[model samples]
Target: METLETLSDKLDTTGDIQSIVRTMKALSAVSIRQYEQAADAVASYAKTIDMGLTAILHDRRAGGLSLPHTGSTDADVAGLIVIGSDRGLCGRYNETVARAAVDCINDRTAVLGVIGARAAARLEAQRHKADRLFLLPGSVAGMTPMVGRVIVEIESWMRERGVETVNVVHNRREGRSRAVPTSSAVLPIASEDLQQLADARWPGPGLPFFRMDRDRLLSWLVRERLFVLLYRALAEALASEHATRLAAMQSAERNIKERREDLTSDYRRKRQETITREMLDVISGFEAVSGSDD
Candidate 1:
C-alpha cells in the first residue's frame, strides 16, 4: 500500500524469471531419465557383446586373428564425431564439446563429422569444414538407429578415403570436458583391428550347442561388434548431454530462488521504511500545530 513504485515491477520480473527457471528444471529432469534409460540399454548390450567377443577370440587358438602388415602404419587421418545438445539452456554443453572437437581436428589433418547443428556452427566458426553434419532426434531412443547408420557410413568413408584413425569427441557425464580422446578403430579389415575385437562368449548353459560355419560366424560377429561400439559411444554421449542439462537447470533454479528471496526482502524493507517515515511526518506535523496553538 505504501507508494513503493518499484514493488510491483520487482514482483513481475522475479515471477517471470522464477517460472523460466522452473521450466528449465522440469525439462532437464525429463532428459536425465531418458538418458539414463538409453545408457542402461546400451551398456547391457555392450557387456553381452564383449563376453561373446572374448569367447570367440579364445576359441581361435592362434591369437584369434593375424596381423597383416608390420607393426608400423602411417599416421591416422582422423575422423572426429562430436556430440552436442540440440537445445540450449544447458550451460556450455555445446560449447565445450565444440571446443574439444576443434582442438582434436586441429591436431591432425582430419575430417570432422559434427553431430549437432550447434556443434557444426562452432566448427564453421573455427573455419573448419565438417565433412558431415548429422541431425539428432529429440529423444535418445531415436538415436540408436541413427548411430548404427552412422557407423556404417563412417566405415565406408574410412575405407574409401583411407582414413585409419577415428575417434569420438564427446562430453563426459561427470560434467568434465575430457578434451579430445583419440581412438583407433577397426578399419580396413586389419588383422590387428580384427584381433582387437574381443572373442565371442560360449553359449550359456541349457542353450543347445549352436553349429555354424566358423568363417561366416566370425564375419557376423565382427560387424555386430562394430555396431555395438558405435551404439555405446552415442548412448554415452547422449547421457552426458542430459546429465549436463539437468545440472545446469538445477543451478539456474537455485539462482532464481535466491534472487526472488532477495527481491522480496528488499520490497518488504522499503515498504516498512515508507510507513515509518509517514508516521514520523504525521507526528511532527501534529506537534508543530499544537506548538503554534500554544
Candidate 2:
C-alpha cells in the first residue's frame, strides 16, 4: 500500500541497518580470533602448571602437604563463581551460564560470585544475591588484573563463609565456533586427578631433588594450581563469549539480507505500478486533446 517515494525511503533505511549489522559482524569475527588466541596461550601455561603439580605431588606424599582453606570434612557450604558476558547481543550466553549456576545450587548453602553485569542481573532476577560481583575484563590484556581480583574475592569468601568447596560455571568452547555450558569443581581437587598426579611417572631420567622445604614447595604448587584453574576458566568463558557473538551476528546478517531483499522487491513493484499509472494518465490526456481537436 506504500507509495513509490515511501518505499524508496524504507529501502534506504533498510540498507543503512544492513550496513550496521555487517560492521558488527566483522567486529565479532575479530574479537573471536583474539579471544581464541588468548585461550590457546593460557592453555600452554596450564599444561606447564599441571606438569609441575604432578611432579610435586609425586615427590611429597609423606610430607603432609596441605592446602589452606581446603575445608574440613564437616564443612558443608559451597562457593560458586559464575562467568558470563556483559553485552546482550550474543544469544542466551548469559542465560545459559546463569541456568547452570542455578542448577548447581541444588539446595546447597552457596555463596555466589558473579562476573559480568548481565550475568549478575540474570541471577538477581532469579532471586539469587551475589556476594561478589565483578566486571569482565575488556580484553585479553586485562585478564591478569581480573584474575588477581577474583583470587582476592574468593579467598575472602572462603574465610567469611567457611566454604567447603568452590565451583565454576561457564560456557566452554567445544569447537571452532561452538560452546556449551560447563561446570567444574576447583577446591578439594578431584580425588581422581590427585591420584593420577600422585601416581604419575616422572618423565625425566631420575627423581630430582628439591632445594626448598617440601611443605613450602607443595603450598606454592597448590596455589599455582588454583590460579591456573581459575585462569583457564576465565579464558574459556571469554573465548566462548566471542564465539557466541560471532554466531549470533552471522545469523543476524542472514536475516538482514532476507529483509533487504524483500524490501527491494517491494520497492521495485511499487515503482513499476507508479510508472504504469503515470503513463496511462499521459495517454488519456493526449486522447482528450485529440477529441477536442476533432
Candidate 3:
C-alpha cells in the first residue's frame, strides 16, 4: 500500500544500510587477520617456554632441586577469571562465555573476576556480583598492557584472599572461522603435568646446567610459565572474538543482500504500476475531449 515516493525513499535508505553493513564486514575481516597473526606470534613464545620448563624439570630431577615453597595454597577458596567481549554486535558471544563461566563456578565462596562489559552485565543479570571488573583492550596493540594489569590483579587477590587455584574461562579458536568455549587451570600448575615432565627425558641428549642458583632459576621459570599462560589465553580470546564478529558480519551481509533484492523488486513493480495508471488517465481524458468535439 506504499506510494511510489515512499517506496523510493525506502530503497534509498536500504541501500545506505547495505553499504554500512558491508563496511563493517570488511573491518571484521581485517581484525580477524590481525588477531590471528598475534596469536600465532605468541604461540611460538609459548612453545619455547614449554621447552625450557621441560629441560629445567628434567635437571631438577637429577639435582634434587625442589620448589622453594610447599606449593600449597588455601584449599577452601579459589578464583576464576572470566573473559568476555566488551561489545555486543557479535551474536551470543558474551552469553555463551558467561554461561560457561557460571557453570565452571561450582563453589559459592569462589571469587570471580570479569573482563568486558557485556560479560559483567550477564553475570549481574544472573544475580552474581563480580569481585573485580577488568576492561578489555580497544585494539590488538593494547593486549599486552591488559594482560599485565590482569596479572597484577590476580596476584593481589592471591595475597589478600589467599586464593589457592586460579582458572580462566574464555572462547578459543577451533576449526576454520569457529570458536569454542574452554576453561583451564592457570595457577599452581597441575600436578599431573609436572609429574609427566619430571619423568620425561630432555629432547637434545646432553644434560644442560644452569649458572644461577637452582631454586632461583626454577622460580623465574615458573613465573615465565604463568606469564606465558596468561598472555596466550588473552591472545586466544581476542582471536576468538574477531572470528565470532566476522561470522556475525558475514551473516548480516547475506541478510542485507536478500533484503535489498526484495526492496528493489518491490520498487520496480510500484513504479511501473504508477506509470501505467497515469497513462490510463491521459487516454481517458483524450477520448472524452474527442467525443465532445464530435
Say which candidate scores most in lDDT.
2
Q: What overall lDDT goes with each candidate model?
A: 0.66, 0.80, 0.80
lDDT per residue for candidate 1 within 151-205, as digits (tens), equals: 8777776668656656677765653422232333433344554456533334575
Q: What C-alpha RMSD separates each model from the true structure?
A: 4.9, 2.7, 2.4
- Ordered by lDDT, highest first, the candidates read 2, 3, 1
- Per residue, candidate 2 scores C-alpha lDDT tens digits across 135-176 of 999887888889889878877877777776888899997776
Q: Summarize candidate 3's per-residue lDDT along 48-67 as a digit string, tens digits.
A: 77677777777766667752
**lDDT of the structure predicted as candidate 3:** 0.80
Better of 2 and 3 by lDDT: 2
Worst 10 residues of 2 by lDDT: 66-75
Q: For model 2, name the residue pairs that clash.
A: none
| Lowest lDDT block of 10, candidate 1 | 175-184
The ten-residue window of minimal lDDT in model 3 covers: 66-75
**Stretches of candidate 1 above 4 Å error?**
1-5, 51-76, 106-109, 175-219, 273-294
